[model samples]
Target: MRTTLWALPVVLSIGLGTGSLAQQRSVTTVGSVMQLMDAMTIPASNAVFNVGRQPPETDEEWSALALSAVVLAESGNLLLIRDRARDEAAWTEASQAMVEAGAAALGAVEARDVDALLDAGDVVFGSCEACHATYLKRE
Candidate 1:
């Protein structure tokens, strides 16, 4: 009887902890794949792309630029999520490209190099184009 009383609380705590673990991973996207891209990836990537045209002038602008690059990098991970990935090989390649492009953009932002940003922008756009051509082309 004494052992059961102690075990009961432990079991209940374990169950509660498991439930919270599931809640913590709340990014399981339920929307259409395109919607996810439109909502997050496209906008974040565009911010990086557009910054090349008008370079950041202030600390605040630089912060925003960095954040946009971070978002773009993280968006690639989002695409690789099991629920979002279409083809294992192709999706992995495309998402990895996004990650690499975002990293380049972030590095350029850190260095405040307009030319490098332009190069990174080309990479970012090309990555998106390649992926879309293969997997996301509208039928």
Candidate 2:
């Protein structure tokens, strides 16, 4: 059975519009973007990661996992918003990696494939680590 991801279109529209609108508007701060990651992306990634230990058993569980993946993917778009981007090259690369990883997780979740979800979780973890290594400030 094919699963429907309700938020995918919304996320796609936002990502598609970012290039043109990003330069025209400055809506959020990098800190705010990070907060979005902490609140949404990280948890979503955890759900993907946890799939190895406890795979979703029901349709509701699967749908919830799909939502998590959507959140993780959309968070990448949020990071790409010009106002929140840290730099031109590396930041863009890392953000795109995040988007791809999230998308992969979503696909795996839709397929109900445990192994692919785990692989996507690895990509998600790598993207997070790379970005943090490059940009995260320490006191």
Candidate 3:
């Protein structure tokens, strides 16, 4: 019984580890980078930026802001997907900046602070500009 129990745990661990590896290997991009930017990142960042001009008043408004911030933050992860990443070093740095700026926006929204949201918006804009300058093709 003791030996069986120990072996069972080992078997389960190996099975779970294999499943995890499989999931990692299967990670794929669903949308093109432009699609993701247009659908998620741009709108979300716009929401954060607009808060400076028209601060959220109702709970529902605040909740919407929260959702936008979350989408923005998660969009950074989407950019980091292996298929979407343009390069290793600069791409990773830019994506991480997006994540951090989004997080800051989320924090500001939670606090109901318009000024802080504006500051975070600036950071988000700077991150976007930095990445676009390096990667975006103008032609």
Query: Evaluated with TM-score, which candidate comes out highest?
Result: 3
Candidate 2 C-alpha error for residue 42, in Å = 1.5
Error of 1 at 48 (Å): 1.2
Q: How many residue pairs clash in model 1? A: 0
For model 3 the TM-score comes to 0.82
For 1-139, candidate 2 gives per-residue lDDT tens digits of 1334777776668868785645666564546866887898888888888888999999999999999999998889888886688888888899999999999999999999989999999999999988988888898
Per-candidate Cα lDDT values, in order, are 0.84, 0.86, 0.89
TM-score against native, each model: 0.75, 0.79, 0.82
**Per-candidate alpha-carbon RMSD to the true structure:** 8.3, 7.0, 5.5
Best model number under lDDT: 3
List model 3 lDDT by residue over 57-100, tens digit each: 99999999999999999899889877688887888788889999
User: Which residue pairs of candidate 3 clash?
Assistant: none
- Full ranking by lDDT: 3, 2, 1
Where model 3 places Cα greater than 4 Å from the true spot, the runs are 1-23
User: Candidate 3 local accuracy as lDDT?
Assistant: 0.89
